[model samples]
Target: MPFSLSIIAEAWPTFEAGLITTAIFCSVASVLGLVLAVPIALAQFSRSWPWRVSAKVLVEIVRDTPFLVQVFVIYFVFPATGIPMSSTVAGILALTIHGAVYFSESIRGAILSVPKGQVDAARAAGMSYPLTMRRIVFPQMMGYVLPPIGNQIVGLIKDSAVLSIISVPELSMAFQNVLGTTFAAPEAFVAVAVLYWLLTSAVTLVMSRLEQLTPTHRSTQEMTSLLAKADR
Candidate 1:
């Protein structure tokens, strides 16, 4: 059977709303999650065992559990504990927490990759810890981390669709509504799929360009290998 996307035009308003919502969700979650992830990543390398353990446990719990279950707990179960939240708020919290766990690992790896001498130089130059990190460490770390960070962001963007399950009316829910009312499942899903692809591909392109531009070459061979893969 030939696939058709013509039906999507009539349903564009719903699709537009869902697309906007997903974009907002991902933009906020990525920023907030990365911010929250920094400390979690740093805690892993802290001298204090309690900090390490707490960070580790939070990461493990998020990594181990299914995201859908986490969403359900936040949306459905938490209300029983008297902490009321809108579905949008619950979805935002769930997505941010979940992505932060994964983002933290990339952050940890990047931190470990930063050269000791650069950090020493920053300290010796009278830079405060926060300033040293902001000026030297994070800038350098992004070179190493940006690709993986991009991967995580793209995954999180796709994963945001799952929020539709709790009634936040993101892309997937928008598609579902179109399907239910118009019975045009193919067109609705095709449109959603294309939109998701465009969004993810844009990130991949930006990150790939950044990876090439950034000087994270701890091992020259690794960069060469990545370039070769891109050529393929």
Candidate 2:
């Protein structure tokens, strides 16, 4: 048989299901990973030696190793150690850990980019540490971080394909299944690639919009006003 779009049309259902799974895994992992990154990033600046050391070691280990190796260890090794997890759980966990460490570094860099003078000023104005972070540091940090964070999200989607090794039923696995039956490697792979591109493209579009709308100055103005009031 010759190359045809019919093969893609027939396999649409499988592809669609796989795309949904991929979306869910990436979506959940992205949110959890970024949320988790905040504390990990903050921990690096903790006054306690143990907190700083632990966070540093974790960031190093996760960032240095291959994500594929991490996925394998989570899926195959942890179960034997009495921490059993389903494939779905394992896949999401691996993605989350991978994303968190990378996102933490980006966050740490963003935090550093915020001028120390601003923080000192906030403190001089009687803002508590938490209050300063909430109203001063975090707002300014968001603009610097958003671009890198957007890139990380795009990378995370691509990384989710590795989950197929553990039978997570994501896009790659779906295409693999279709290929197994149809043996149309070209059509199966092309379709999967296109879907991945589409998914990542959509995420990029949203991130771009967010970057444009980032209220860095407005937030600073509002927080500065609040801080001024507190000073008074």
The candidate that wins on lDDT is: 2
Give one digit per residue, the lDDT tens place, for model 2 in 130-227.
99999888888888898899899999999999899989999999999999999998888889999999999999999989988878654455679989
Residue-level lDDT tens digits of model 1 in 52-144: 999999999999999999999999888999999899999999999988999999999998888778778889999988898888888778777
Candidate 2 — what's its lDDT?
A: 0.92
* TM-score, per-candidate, Cα-based: 0.84, 0.91
- Candidate 1: pairs in clash: none
In model 2, the Cα lDDT at residue 112 comes to: 89
Model 2: ten consecutive residues of lowest lDDT? 214-223
Which segments of model 2 are wrong by more than 4 Å? Answer: 218-232
Q: Any idea what lDDT model 1 has?
A: 0.88
Residue 49 local lDDT, model 1: 100
In model 1, the runs with Cα more than 4 Å from the true position are 116-128, 208-232
